[model samples]
Target: MPSQATTAPRVALVTGTSSGIGAAVVEHFCKLGHQVLAVDFNPAGKAVAGKAGAVFYEADLSDPDACRGAVTEAVKRFGSVDILVNNAGIQHVASIETFPEEKWHQIIDLMLTAPFLLTQAAWPHMRKKGWGRIVNVASIHAQVASPGKAAYTSAKHGMIGLTKTAALEGGEQGITANAVCPAYVKTPLVDNQIADQAKLNNMDEQDVVEKIMLKQAAIKRLIEPEEVAQLIAYLASDAAGAVTGSSFNIDLGWTAH
Candidate 1:
């Protein structure tokens, strides 16, 4: 059981909460008794928020101003943010040579810049209260590499850098910043990727999963979003106060070899 004080109705801001890992994290925090602010541009977010009993904010995090607005809205609705989960992201598939400039900018802006801006806005409040948790939902791609995902990889890599810097600055103020980097999780995002990889590699969906996605994993299976949510819940807990500036991998041994 969670402590009442630790699991009390603290304000939490979770981005990209319409589906996948983001949605799972929001639901997990809500179950722990936190008042969550779920932000996502997806129309499904409203329904998810209702189910989770969390306040919802619909906004495109790719926009810097929208990122700031998310923080502002969370503050207004929930009083002060005790946890900020930077999870809004999208994937673009293309090699460096063929990657569209616009798509590159969009991915960077959304996956990397939005986290920076949101953290910036939330920092003062966290600093003032002398307690905070910032969890960046990065990818294993942040450390490893795959073909046709330069923009996605770069953005995730940048998130790790931001996590370290913020952790250094916020340590004295009782704020902790860390990232969770996972390999392919069984989400709608990865479901879409199955078809994309099939077309890209001229293979069937099963072949793509077997020959590509799980080929590097020692576990030979995709991770579940709930598993990632459990890790986020731990990081947000007071028990994890000493863990900061770390990239905890749930990568199924992808990086082992």
Candidate 2:
């Protein structure tokens, strides 16, 4: 029913489809009648893609070659990649003084570099089509910083830069590049953060949620994955043709102050 009103079905290559924001994006695009190629390291992603009628490609984006291969596989199977959702991410929480070097490279590769690689691989196809949409799932961390998130903040910040750069390059073509930056959301990643923050802050998980997480947020709650998915769907739609080179914050006012 939701798929009935689309201009035509296009292919969307979405990373991190195992769960959370990535999973929600897959569902949204499918409802909008697009063919989705779901990429994730987790095997669970296969089932998620199957249920959503998306093709699944399991990949660890830390490897640069894999990022290129993912786009190629999508093109091979679907003909073109009209939309790219660079939503894959992992978090590492620790003071910069105590962060591991390997973890830094790993986080940076997956969050920041992989998006660029995937976008590069998908560029020619979009150029051929004369239209494309790229939605990078950045975070409030992309705009602001937190105490124990050195690696995460750095990678997310880079994502914003990548989004802007992509926008400038894609402008001449009909491709638009944008980012959806959300505040803390209820996902396994955030749940892990809740637990880690409690230990790091010497508080219970509930205190971390109430005091730390919501302290700067006006909404006083975690954002839902569907809420983010809706925005991604919009950016990937024709309605958002002029919305490129922008970072839209769904941060619940975390950055307002």
TM-score of 2: 0.96
TM-score of each: 0.96, 0.96
lDDT of each: 0.90, 0.91
lDDT for residue 105 in candidate 2, whole number 0-100: 94
For 18-84, candidate 1 gives per-residue lDDT tens digits of 9999889888888889999999999899899989989889999888899889889988887888899
lDDT, candidate 1, equals 0.90
**Against the correct fold, how does model 1 do in TM-score?**
0.96
lDDT of 2 by residue, 59-113 (tens): 9999999999999999999988999999999987777788889999999999999
Candidate 2: residue pairs that collide: none
